[model samples]
Target: MLRRFGSKFLQNSLLLTLSGLYSTAALHAQQPAVNPAPIPLNPSQKAAAIAGNVQGKALIQQATALLKSGQLDSAIPILQRASVLRYVDPTSHFYLGLVYDQKGMSQMALENYTLAIKRANALGMDSAQLRINLGNTLCKLNFLKEAEFDYKRAIEIDDKNDVAHLNLGRVLLFKGDNQGAFRELSRASALMATDPNLPLYQALALKGMGNNEECKNQLQIFLDRAAGTHSDPRVISMAQNLLAELK
Candidate 1:
């Protein structure tokens, strides 16, 4: 059964580097156990499955190309097919989760990310990035408690993970834990100062604590950097909208 877990093209090609949301890493396929238990497959069944695995790999490559070109709709079906293959590994499922995420299919994203994490753990691979990915999906679903747990667990695995700090801060803000949000956002900003979202979140935390002036200051800082260097239209718009709502 494990013979289908081929070493060829074991490296996942997709790199999920979405800032403030999903973290990234290519999934490495570990070799199966030596002399793995044999499961009886009829000749026809074996042939068909091997062919399916090849098709799965091709679909994964196609999906990766589509994702890189920002053709999310085209990538989704290919990734979905790849995930169902008998030899499909964590990487395929992880990419499927990412594609679903990009398409704003939060429920589907959560499901696939969960599957990816499970497969990663089963394969004895590191799952820190998958945890962050799943945590982001949980946040999108407003599952703050679960999201916090995932982020904290990821932080425990790697203390220097700035994305975990940033996301944890956002979740805390949503939970109305202003002080906690402030502390985590501060840590995240200290780790990556150029992140425009950090100050924007910190400002929200300050606003929740009734520090209107401080909040305004933070928003201004966010706006200045976001518009000048970082310059994400969404970030700039969010900061400007918040600033307008404040004064």
Candidate 2:
């Protein structure tokens, strides 16, 4: 994953208790008790919830496979069906967010991600992945302060989460906190050295600090990594041109 301004959705799925885009089996298995007990579900309501979970799980599985195949049109309805189930976990809402995000439905994505976070928190599962994803969506919607809070919260839960560090660096950079950006990105680099785009952000942080030599070195590192590993060609080309200018 790119360190700055990149979606952590895919990475977050793998890293968290939520395993994939649409698997809520783990959450369903737990059935965590709600903290402030509201009117408890009646027997009929309980039966419906159980039935909803079974149907929802099957729908989610199908939706996940469809999403992986780039079948967003097909996945959306399945995900929508899954989202209404009482037993559906944050993962379902999260994938719904992703599907909406992919379909250019920013408002819908934000709504579902928000719901996912709320549901996750209510379940007493402070998943770092959920926070990072919510942060990413918040950033996309220009909710920078909210994004920063989520990223910071993610770090608090899992201090070593590189995705949180990477995202926090970008948020700090945008806020003109270059030193803070450098610190977070450096920590991310320590955790994820093989990522090709990190040095580019580091270079930008150095440039903001007026440390031109270090900036150039970071740009060179980006170029080397880009050449040897996977990276967006547009980003790599930009780095190459910037490196020459720095030289």
Candidate 3:
């Protein structure tokens, strides 16, 4: 699967790093083992179906190339056509969702991601990364509870997925589950020691838990790491204000 996107895609669009998208595994051990019964087809029918799939794969390849070149508009129609083809790759819908997300069409992105999930599930290609992507879209739409479910599902699919833990923690923090957020963020920090955002999030969770001193310490750590980096100015400002409040 073409996991990497053009520089214009997902650039500072997510709070977490894009590195997770590339490192994710495509299959999970916990996925259902039962395969769907195969449908019997005559020679001519099977040949036609195989040809259709080949065409779908070709369209997906074309769309992927367009996406990598930052030609989002050109990729959309190709991906759309691929998505509706018989035996189409679920990744066609995933890429479509990514294009829509980059274009700031959140609803369309959410719908496509949902379709991708359904198709992936049917094909036994459901993965933690897929759930994380869907969760992120739901979060953008302010569907916090639904986002929480998807994040949790991602965690279940791959407990070692630090990105899933980080996102779940953020959602929990927003929902006032400070302790839950703290636990998940702590796990994320343990898994990805160098992610500067973890300490910032941990600080927020601590503040919500009335651990002001620990919050201040984490804030200072975040500030130190964020300095000379391309950290979000709003996040830096918020951290500074919180640090001052604890003083």
Candidate 4:
């Protein structure tokens, strides 16, 4: 537990020093979320496009199976071939990017996501989400300013994007602007009445603001939830320990 805490602490520090170019969230910036939404093609039209174009659908299915089975390297070629053949559906690109991102191939993930977004950027396009994703990737690469650009644009497009707000809060926290972090995170928590994983952060923010009673209350709630669901052990632990500290 101590080691996990230390590791998390180091990760936060590194996120600040290494990825702190701008105050933007990096949730999916490099590829998936940062990339544009997939344009929906009619299923019949898509099937017709590849009617004689080789077994694109089959290959994509194979790639999916491979991914689910944990054969990442094997899935890559199959997915890429499908992508190159116009057999690549938006779902294919999205999942392909998912695999690439999981493997730390940020550039590859970004490329596929971009392709998916461009192909699917019409009606169903969640442009703001794409910007946030790309912003996240940008932050990881130390392009803080660019990341900031993406986040700000995302806010402009949709101020109510909860993930965007939460991500921005994390970015602020890493930047050591505790007040900024508190404000953003507090808003996020208020919006998170439906999400049970955030009380720990809410507690942290309250504690930072010297609201020990509020912090303790949030911590108790966090512990109660954690015991039932195991959804946030680290947060529960931290909240508990912090509550003890404040006492």
Best by lDDT: 3
Tens digits of per-residue lDDT, candidate 3, 1-247, equal 1222321122223233321222222212122222333558899988987787778879977877787788989999998887776443567778777888778787998998888788777766667777887788888777989989999998998899988998899888777788999999999988884556778778777877878788789889989999999777767775676566556
Q: TM-score ranking from best to worst?
A: 3, 2, 1, 4
Estimate, for each residue in 32-89, the C-alpha lDDT of model 2 and write its tens digit. Answer: 2233224478999878877987888899888888877788888888888787864437
Q: Which pairs of residues collide in model 1? A: none
What is candidate 4's lDDT per residue for 83-161, written digit by digit as tens? Answer: 7665334545766766766677777766765667665554345466666666666656656566566666667777777
What is candidate 1's TM-score against the reference?
0.69
For 56-108, candidate 1 gives per-residue lDDT tens digits of: 87998888887777788888778788777744376677887777777778899
- Alpha-carbon RMSD to native, per candidate: 14.1, 9.0, 9.8, 7.9
Which candidate comes out best when scored by TM-score? Answer: 3
* Weakest lDDT window of 10 consecutive positions for candidate 1: 7-16
TM-scores, all models, native as reference: 0.69, 0.77, 0.83, 0.58
The runs of at least 3 residues in candidate 2 whose Cα sits more than 4 Å from the true structure, single-residue gaps closed, are: 1-39, 228-234
Error of 1 at 46 (Å): 9.1
Provide the lDDT at 102 for model 3.
76
